[model samples]
Target: MHNKTKLLIFASLLLAACSTDPMQEIPNRGDSAPEIETSDKICNTSDDAVAGSLIVKFGEEAIPSLEQNALNAAKTRSALTRSGIESVDDILNDLHVTSLERVFPEAGEHEARTRAAGLHRWYVLGFASEEDLDKAAERLADVAEISKVQFRTRLYRASDCKTYPFQATANGQTRALVTADFNDPNLFWQWHYINNADQAVATTSVAGADINVADAWKLTAGNPEVIVAIVDEGVKYTHPDLAANMWINPNPSPEYKNQDIHGWNFAADGPISWGQKGDSGHGTHVAGTVAAVNNNGIGVCGVAGGTGKGDGVRLMSCQIFSGDLTGDALVSSRAVKYAADHGASILQCSWGIKAGIYTSDNMFIKQSPMDYEALQYFAAQKNCEALDGGLIIFSAGNESTAMSGYPAGYRDYISVTSFSPDYLPANYTNYGSGCNIAAPGGETSGLSGGEKAGVLSTLCSETSNGADYGYMQGTSMACPHVSGVAALGLSYALEKGKRYSLDEFKTMLLTSVNEIDSRLGEGSKATIADVSIYRGKMGTGITDAYQLLMQIEGTPCLRVALGEVQLIPLTQHFGQGAEDLTYTDIQMSAKDMEKLGIKAAPKMYNGKLMIKCTKPGSAKIKVSAIAGGTKPGTGVVMGGMVITKEFAVIARSAGAANGGWL
Candidate 1:
C-alpha cells in the first residue's frame, strides 16, 4: 500500500472510533449509564422556534479535546461514505450544528477539576431541529466518556407584581411622618425599616413587624468590604441611589476589557446594561432594597445602604434574566459560578423554577446535572473569609403553595418567604418546611385598610435616562430584605472580630428570629391553617436584624432561679473591669423585671446585680456600661457613649421542676 493511502485510512479509522457509541465500550455500561429521558413539557421557550438544547458532561476530557471529538463525530455522521469525504471541513457544511460551547469555564480550571472531576466540562449543544437534537443527545448519552446528559432547562424570576403605583396610598389619605434623617425625605415611608406606632404614617405598620434596620444601622450602617451579587434580570447600575454602591471590577481580562466596569451581563454574554426598552423593573427594585445609597436626600432608604459616608455594601449585577425577564438554567448556573469566583460574599437570587413544574418526588428525575454541579461548585468556594463561606439567598416563590422551587428548595441555599406588614404570611408567598425564614415582602390587596403595602424601593423610569421609585410585592421582594439583613449581620460580625462558618451563620440567622406564632398567640403551630399547609413549618421564624446583630455581639443569656435570691455578676457577663460601673449606669425597665416576676435592682456589689425572683417567667433586660472614672495618670476620659447589652432571663420554679428539666 502507498504511504499516503495508509495515513488516510488511519485517519478515517480514528474518526470512526470517535464517532461510535463510546458507552458501549464500557464494562457494564447499561447498569452504570444514567437514564436519558425527554418530555413535551417545555423546559424553555423563546420568540424563535423551540430549539433543542442538551447539557453534555464529557468525563476525563478537556473542553478543547471534546470540541475536536464532537467535530469529528459530526463530519463522520454527515458523510454518506467515508471514502467519498475529502476533508472534515467539507463534511461540516452538510451538518447543522447551531452551537456547542462550554457551560462554565469561569468556574476556573483548578477548582473545577478538583471539585467536579468527571463532571468538570459541561457543554450546551443546540440543534436546528428538535428531532435532530433528540437523536444527538441519545447518541451522546451512549458515549462511555460522557458521565451525565440532560436537556437544558429554563428558570423564571419569582414574580414581583406591582399592584399599585409608587406613591399611591391605599386609602388616598395623607399622613404625618417622621424621618430618620432630614436629608432622607422618604425614610419615613420605609415601614420595613422603622415600623413606628403612628397609624397615620404607616396605616398597616405593626410595632416590631419591621426588620429593625434602624437600630442595626446605629451599630454600623455597612462596611464597603462586603459585596452582594444580585442575580436577576439586570440592575440599573447608573441609578443615582444604586450607583455609589455598585461593585466595580478592579481587574478585567482582555476579552472583558473596559466592558465589565459594573458587572457582567451573563444573559447577553457581554458587559452589563440595565436593560433595553420595555423591560420589567425587577432587578433595579431588588438592588435598591439591598443597597440603594442612603441619606441621599432622594429615594427610599436601603436596609444596609450605609450612613451616607460611602461605607455601604457593594452590589454586583449578575444579569441572568434579560429584557423579557426570562432566563435558562445553564446561564443562571454560570452567573452563580462567576459571582462566587469574583468578590461577591452574598448572592441574592430572586429567581427560580416555577413550583408546580416539578414536585419533590420527580425533581431529580428532571434535574439538570450541569446546574446541580455548578451550584455545588459555588457552595464550596469560601468567598467571604469573614463569614467563613459564601452565602446564597433565594425567594421561596409566589405560588401560595406549601412547596418551594428549585435552587431555593435546594438545601444549600437559604429560602426566604414573604410576610405582610400585619405579620401574616403574604397572600402569595409559598410556605412549608422549605421556607428558611420570613421577611416583609408586602401585599397590596385583601386588606381592610385598603393599604397598598407592597415594599417601596428605587426603580427606573419607563423611558429616558432617569430614575424613579415603586412598590412591588412577592417573595422576590422578601428575599432581598433577608440579603440586606444578612449583610448587616456580617458587618456586625466583622466589626466584633467574630467569624462563623456558613452553617453556623445560618444557624444564627434561624435562631435570631422572633417566634411569630408564639407572639401571635398561635403557640407551637408550624403552619397557619388559613395560609400554609403545615403550621410552624416555616424555618426558624421571621428574621430580626436587631436580634441577629445581638447574637453576633455575644449577648449573655440569664437563667434565674424562681422564688429565690440570685446574684448575676455583671463583670462576668460584661467582661473584666466592669466593677467600676455603677447601678444607675446600667439601664433596665421596671416593667421588664415585673414581667419576669423578679425584684431586681442594679445594686452593684463588686459589679454584680443582687436580685430576688418573686415568680417564674421570662423577661429581656437591657443594660448599658457607663464611663469609668478617668484612668489614673493617663488623663484620658473613657467610655462616654453607652454600650447596651440585652439579656434574656428565664425564671424557673425551684420546687416545681419536671422530670424533663432534670
Candidate 2:
C-alpha cells in the first residue's frame, strides 16, 4: 500500500478507538444522562421532574473584567433592566444571562477570590434538557456582561424508612431506658457493656485482663456538670435512666412549646406520626451509652454512672433519622449544624449508610469505596477547623469491606472500625483508607473456635413494646465505644486548660487506641486500658481509664487572670500559686477595658489584687509583652480560668465590692 493510504488507515483506526460507544468505557454513560445514584428513592412526581433541571456552575471564566466594567455599565435600574440583567442573584440563577462578579481595584489586601475578574465567582444556572443547554449557551454568547455558562449535575438523596419495634417515648417526659435483662445469652454477651456487672466494675472483661472502666467511671460516675448533646433520632426523653442526663435546650423554636426540646423532634412526622408508636430506639440506646443514670440497681450502668455527679452530658436529640437513616446528606448536615450551634462539643451520629456500596464487586471485600465527596463535605463543616474545636466519631460501617462509609471516610473524622480482643476486624465491619482508627465495635456470630467479638450496650427492643438495653454487634455497636472514649478525651483536654481543634482531637483519639493481637496484622488495634495489653493489633492497647485520668490530672492548668493573657508556664510544683506572682503583659488599656464594658479598673489597694467580670459567658482578656502588640493595642486574650466566684456576685449586683482591685 502507498504511504498515504497507510496513514489514512491509521487515522481511521484512531477515530474508531475514540468513538462514543458504551461498550468500551469502564462506567459507560451510554446515550442517557449521567446516572447520579442518590441515597433517596427517586421521587417520580412532577415536582421531582421539575427539580431535575441541571444546575451549572461557572468560575473565573464567568466574572466581570474589572470594577471599571461594572461602573462603566448602565448604572440606572431601567438601563440594567433593558440590558436584561437586574442584580447579582439573577445573573447567578438565570439561564439566559451570564453574571459576572465585580471586584474593586483599591483593595488593600488581594483576596484569593478577587485577584482575577472571574477567578472565584461561582455561576449557577438551570437547564431542563440538552436542547436547553444549547439555548443557554447561545444567550451567553450574545450578552456582553456575561462571561461563560457551565452546566453542573447535582446528586439527590433521602432517608430510608426502616422500622424496628419499640415506643419512641417510654414515659411521655424526661428519662430514657439504657439497659435490659440477660435472658438471651447471645444478646446478653453482645451488650456486656450495659448490665454486665463483671465487665462494668471488673478491671477488664474476658477479652483481655488489663481493661478497667475506672477512668470513665471517675469522670462521669460522680455525674460532673458536663452536658453532652445526643444528636440522633428524637430520644425517648422519658426513659428512666436517661432523664437525669438528658440535656434541656434553654433555646427552643417558637413553633414548639418546649425550649429544651434538649430533647428535640427534627423528624418530618409529628407526635402521632407513623413510627411514634414504636420509635426505632437508636438514640435512646446511644444516650444510655453516654450517660444512663447508673447503679439504680434496676436496668444497667452507664460509662459515667453516678447518682448525678458527672457534669451532665445532656442528651440533645437533633433527630436526623426516623429510624432507618437511609442516607440523607442534607438532613445530616442540618443536624450537625444544629448540634454545633447549640454547644455540643462532642457530636454522636451512631447511625449511617454506606453511600458507595456497589461501585466495585470484589467478592472478598464486597462493597464500593467510601464516598469521597460526601465525606469531604462533613469534614469541611467541622467547627474545629475554623470555628470552635469539636470532634465527630462514626462507625467504620458494617459492610465487612475494607472501606468506611461517608462522614467516616473523612480523615478529619474519627473513623472507628470494630475489633475483638481476639484481634480481628469484625467479620461484618468495614475498614480501609487505613481510615482514622479502630475500636471494639464487637463481632457477629462468625469467629474462630466459636469465639466472637462481644459488646454490651443499651438497646430498645421491640419485643417488649418499651425501651430496654441489650447487646449487639456490627460497627454500629462499636461506634459508641469510641464516642464514649472521645467524650473522655474532650473532658481531658478541657481539664488541661486547653482546647484542641478537630484535627488535634482526632489525632489524640487515634493515638489513644490500644492494639490487640489478631489476623488482620500488626496494624490492627483498638483503644487501650480495657484489656490485657496485646501487641500488633493497632489499638492504643485498650482505652486506659486510669492512665488517661492520670494524664488529664498531670496536664497543668494555665493560671489566667481576668482581662489578660498571662503565661504562667506550668511548673512541677502542685497546688495553686501564691497571690503575689503577677501574670505579665495583660491587655488592660483604658479603651480595651472599656470596650469590654468594664467600668472599674483593678486598683492596687494595699497589698491585694482584685478583678471583676462584667460580662457573662467567655469574655476577652488580651496580653502582650509589648505595650501595643494587640488591637486597641496591647495583650493576648486570657480565655481560660474560672471567674464564677467574682463574676457571679457582680452580675447579680451592680455595686458588689467589685472583687478587690489590683
- Candidate of highest lDDT: 1
- Cα deviation at 16, candidate 1, in Å, is 26
Q: Per-residue lDDT for 1-662 in model 1, tens only?
A: 01222222333334322332222222222556554332322222232222565665544323344444444544464311111123322322333545555565422233323233333345565545544544554555554445555665667778654534466333322224343442666666666666533364345445455676665676877778888999987788888888989888887534354477777778777777654754667888899899888877777788778888898889998898776535777778778877777778898999887665556633633354456555665566676657877888999898887777777877768989887666667777777746788888877665433334678787767532343777778899999999999998888887888888989998888776754453333222122334323347556777777677777877665655556676787676667877776444455578766655555564456677666766433456776665554322234744354566777554433322321211
lDDT of 2 by residue, 31-122 (tens): 45243332111111112122213222222222333222334442332111112244333433564333332111111122221222221222
Q: Cα lDDT of model 1 overall?
A: 0.64
TM-score of each: 0.73, 0.50
TM-score of 1: 0.73
lDDT of 1 at 63: 34
Q: Global lDDT of each model?
A: 0.64, 0.40
| Residue runs of model 1 more than 4 Å from their true location after superposition | 1-50, 61-64, 67-95, 106-119, 129-133, 168-182, 197-204, 361-366, 448-451, 463-467, 519-534, 557-586, 589-662
The list of candidate 2 runs beyond 4 A from truth reads 1-205, 209-211, 219-227, 255-260, 269-279, 305-307, 323-327, 353-388, 421-423, 447-454, 461-464, 492-498, 518-542, 555-662
